[model samples]
Target: MSDYIVEFNNVTKEYVRQVALQNISLKLPRGKLIGLVGPNGSGKSTILKLIAGLVRPSRGSVRVNGRQANRMLASEISYLSELDVLYPFYTVAETIDFNAGLFRNFDMAKAREMMSFMQLDPGKKVKDLSKGNRGRLKIILSLARQVPLILMDEPLSGLDPLVRDSIIQSLISYLDLEQQTVIMTTHEVTEVEPILDTVVAIQNGQLRGMAEVEEIRMTHGQSLVEWMKHNLA
Candidate 1:
């Protein structure tokens, strides 16, 4: 068995005239919380889509768990997009039940626990919830699943710092790092920095650098944001 859960072998993803990812290659190890950090339009989401089998690479190969990435990997991956995909007509509890029905590995106990942890009102309609609460629910939906890979795109987009803090705590508490690998893309670098084991920096549809989170602080005396700035410069 290989150590990597995801392998991108010189992958390139192009759409129309725009190239999202250009000849990128990296091996993402198993059982770690990784942050895919980059500026907007820097291909962060593209990477997650490829991993989730929502999109294919225009060139090279994308493999998840040694198999070619495809819709069949749905059982292996849980993807949370930046956009709102929740059924607004359903109540919070109903939405949880809906997701529980879709996947056998969906942990109902964990989902309820996270709903409570997120302070989401079960009886309230999804449309009635605040944006922050909706974001919390999205996190719960993705994290409650017992899967090898969790892909989150801009998970902390609109929330205030305090809410982000709680969400980050839940991310640490709920995940089993021995079994799961979380790849999250977020603009809130400073906020999510504490939970990340590794950081992969991408810019202008190309790989800029990759580094361990602790190494940057101990060796370079820099935060993830500072490291990104230096690399992107």
Candidate 2:
């Protein structure tokens, strides 16, 4: 079995004429929280989409759990999209049921726990949810699965500071890092710095650097936020 939960080998992604990622090669170690950090349009989300198999690379390969990314791999991976994936008409209960029916690894009890933790009403429809709640719902849905890998795009985006902090704390407490590898894309370097084990910095579709949080602090003598700014500057 591959030691890495996810791997990108010389990957390139394009949208029509625009190159989103180019000649990217990286491997994410199993069972850790990894932050993909960069500015807007820096290929951070593209990398997550590629690993989730939502998009195909124009070149090279994306592997999950030792297999090429595909529909089968979808069961082993959970993707929290930057955009809403929930149908507006679905009630919270129905939405959970719908997703629970799809992935065999899904745990309904865990889903309920997450909903309760997030203070989401089971009768509430997706359309009625606030931005923070919607984000929470997405996170709950993703974490409900007993998958080996998780990909999230901007998990902290457009949230109140208190709400963001709560979500982060819940993630740290709820996630079993020994069994799951979470790779998330975000611009909130400072907010996520505390939770991340590794940081992958990208700019203009190329890697700026990849380092452990400790490495940044010990070797570089800078916080992840400061190191990111300095590296990307």
Candidate 3:
């Protein structure tokens, strides 16, 4: 049996009268490229935050590597948020070195290589770089971490077609599926469809569907984007 890296059991998260997640139960096994897809208000980011231990469930339990998600497991998981969170004054190399110092599992060499592959200058300050470069930097930093699980929230947002293609290629080339699992949330389903192993769709804080990408395509007889529009609309 595959070892489960993340398990959500009857999880419920609420913000006062609003329920962000409802009885969410999911078992994410190690080493799979899982895609989370849904509409704007579908709580996709919430799930990523929950797994990253940024938020706690109101009820039930969330486990990461068989331990409670709240505990410190910085070396085991790396989360790339939807928003850029780098220090504006820091240079790209400085940011990488800071993360390397903070996390024992961070690979400085891998980080440097990724920066070079992305054509991102190490000396460029975060504030001075273009949006695309910032996005690339975030991806590079997240990917350089030698962790078991990586969660990315909207990693491809706000990029041109060419840069998007480059980012996708870089992601695929850097990932080692045998040793790591990647969970990414994106509304750009068509661009990601080719590489996703599994798809998990959520609507209005509830799981709409979960299946292998091939199975979804076979059953619907359409691409993931077409299926998503047909189902989500």
lDDT of 3 by residue, 55-93 (tens): 999999989888889737766888999887999999999
- Per-candidate Cα lDDT values, in order, are 0.94, 0.89, 0.88
| Evaluation by TM-score, superior candidate among 2 and 3 | 2
Name model 3 segments beyond 4 Å from true. Answer: none
- In terms of TM-score, which candidate is strongest? 1
Where is the poorest 10-residue window by lDDT in model 1? 158-167
lDDT of 2 by residue, 152-173 (tens): 8998899999889878987897
What ranges in model 2 sit over 4 Å off? none
Task: Pull out the clashing pairs in model 2.
Answer: none
Arrange candidates by lDDT, descending: 1, 2, 3
The CA lDDT at 153 in model 3 is 95
What is the alpha-carbon RMSD of candidate 1 to the true structure?
0.7
TM-scores for all candidates?
Answer: 0.99, 0.96, 0.95
